[model samples]
Target: MLTKLLITDDAAFMRMTLKRIVTSAGYDVVGEAANGQEAVDLYKELNPDIVTMDITMPTMDGIEALQEIKKTDPNAKVIMCSAMGQQAKIVEAIQHGALDFIVKPFDHSRIIEALKKASDR
Candidate 1:
């Protein structure tokens, strides 16, 4: 089955990029959120199989949203996306239940690979 995915990023361009890549790779982009708060809300509404989350965003950061989502549903699969040099945040996200991560400036392969890992999780 196609993996249903929720995309959360503060930037519209990044969200579009991820949506394109994920959809092209055959995963369904079930929803898109411009901020972490929106992400949290959408997660509950959509219950997507996986989520691609940005570490930095207004209203709420991905880490906090991730935590909130976990609180809502522990089995919710989230894959964090971040720019380079945020290893600490990435680790924290993983510790808080992020299934995997994809660094920004992402190529098609990395996005697909991350989605694959999230689906497996």
Candidate 2:
């Protein structure tokens, strides 16, 4: 089965770019969210196979959302997205239950590889 993914990013362009990459790689995008809170909500509603979450967002941050999602589903699969130079947040995300981290400006190969790795875990 094609893995279902929920993409969360405050920037529309980032969401669009991720959607393009994930779809091209044969994953089904179940939903999109503009913030971490929405990501958490949609994660509960959609229960997607995977989630690509941006670290900085309005309402809540990705680490908090990742924690919330993990609380709800301990086996939840999440891969954090951050811009270059957010090492601290990336480490926090991994500790908070993110399976992997993807740096922006999005690279298709990196995204695909991350998804594959996260899905396998």
Candidate 3:
């Protein structure tokens, strides 16, 4: 079976771009969310194999959502998405049970590699 993925990002363009890249890579795009709260809700409903989560968002940012998800499912596979200069938050996310992180503007190879690593764990 193809790996299922839930992509969560506030930016419409980023979501679309990520969807395209992962779909092309042969992952099934199981769900998408615009913010952290939505991500958490979709996570419960879809129970995707992995989540690509954006750190900065309007409501209930990625770290908080990651925490919430972890509380519910300790083994949840989450790969945080971060931009440059968010080192503190990235470290926090990792400490909060995120499996890994992907630096944005989304490197295709890195994204795939992170997914592989997260899933392998």
Q: Candidate 1: list runs displaced more than 4 Å.
A: none
lDDT per residue as tens, model 3, 37-116 = 99999999999999999999988899999999998899999999999999999999999999999998999999999988
| lDDT-superior candidate, 1 or 2 | 2
lDDT (tens digit, per residue) of candidate 1 on 1-121: 8889999999999999889888888989889999999999999999999999999999999999999999999999999999999999999999999989999898789788877877776
Which regions in candidate 3 have their CA more than 4 angstroms from the true location? none
TM-score of each: 0.97, 0.98, 0.98
Q: CA lDDT, every prediction?
A: 0.92, 0.95, 0.95
Model 3 lDDT on a 0 to 1 scale: 0.95
Q: How many residue pairs clash (N, CA or C atoms closer than 3 angstroms) in each of the candidate models, in the order given?
A: 0, 0, 0
**Residue 90 alpha-carbon offset, candidate 2, angstroms:** 0.3
